[model samples]
Each structure stands twice: as C-alpha cells, then as structure tokens.
Target: MTEIQAGLTVCTVLVVPYIVQAIKTKAMTGNVARWIAISVSTLCGVLTAMAGGMPTDASAWVTSIFAAVGGVQVAYAAFRSVGVTDKWLDALLALGDIKED
Candidate 1:
C-alpha cells in the first residue's frame, strides 16, 4: 500500500482499540493513564500528519477527525476525573459513563 494508506491503517489499528476499551470500561477514573496516552498519541498523529509530508486528501481527513474525537474524549475524561459536573460536562462525561471519584 501507499505511505498514506499505511499510515492511516496504522493509526486506525492503534486508535480503534483504545476507543473500544474506553467505551467498554464505562469509567474513566482509573483509566487516566490510557486517556493521557491516547491524547498524546492523537496529538502526535496530528503533528506527524502536518510535518511528515503525508497525503492530506483522505488519510489526513480521517486522522484529523479521529484525533479530534479522541482529544475530546480525553478532555472529557480529565474533567470527569476532577469531579466537575455541569450540563455540558455531564453530556460529554456521559459519553463514557465516567463518574467522579
């Protein structure tokens, strides 16, 4: 496969499992490490896509979309872990059923 295709495939393989696990766990309190790791990974993906001379057509789009989603997930998890709950926070936190510790 082409380089973009390969990169996209690798990103998918790495990200999908974490997304699935986050959804399956339904609790982000104890998963801070994982969330942090995912956040960093997504950030790296964003940087790499910007700098690695990769194609921006479809692979960039997919990576950006997933990275945004994962970033939001990580932010929500962090907020939930801090026990800050409001309507918006609740909605975001509710995505993973994260509870305050």
Candidate 2:
C-alpha cells in the first residue's frame, strides 16, 4: 500500500475502537445513539487532522478543519451530557447552593 493509505489505515484502526468503547459504556444516561454519534464525530476530528497533513491534497486543509470543528462541538456536548464538569465550576456552583435544601 502507499504511505498515505497505510497511515490512514493505521489511524483508522486506532480510532475506531475508542469510538466503539465509548458507545459500549453505560456510565452516561440520555440517548445512547447520541453518544455513538459523538464518538464518530470525534473520529472525524482525527481524520481531519490526518487528512489536513496530506501533501497531495490542498482542499483537505480547509475541509478537514471544518470537520474537526464539528467534531469538537459533538465532543463537548458529549462531555457535558456525561457530567464531566470542571472542578472550579463545580465549586462555584456549590457556593451558591445549600447543603440541605
């Protein structure tokens, strides 16, 4: 196989399992399908970065970046749905709340 093709294959092998596992885990609630979509979207981000670096294609540079941004949006939403909050934010929210209310 060509170098670029080989590289893309390797990257796909590495990313697909992560996406599968993220969907397999049931730690989060809400829509399971949405989590699967998020995982694929994140994979698209990986694809975008890889595609962006190809020397043969100039269009990939622009298109891949947009795909990456969409992936980022999905990933952020996934994190938010899973309760993956920042410590500072949690602390700030706690300050305005009561222990027993």
Candidate models: Cα lDDT each: 0.54, 0.49
Which run of 10 residues does model 2 get worst, by summed lDDT? Answer: 16-25
lDDT of 2 by residue, 21-61 (tens): 44443575546645554566555644655653544565554
Q: Give one digit per residue, the lDDT tens place, for model 1 in 1-101.
A: 34764465456444544443445434555466455556655665565565546555876756664655465565545545665433444466479765679
User: Model 1: runs farther than 4 Å from truth?
Assistant: 1-5, 8-29, 51-101
User: Which one wins on lDDT?
Assistant: 1
Look at candidate 1 and tell me the lDDT of residue 66: 69
True-structure Cα RMSD, model 2 = 10.9
Give the Å error, residue 41, model 1. 1.9
TM-score for model 1? Answer: 0.31
TM-score of every candidate:
0.31, 0.32
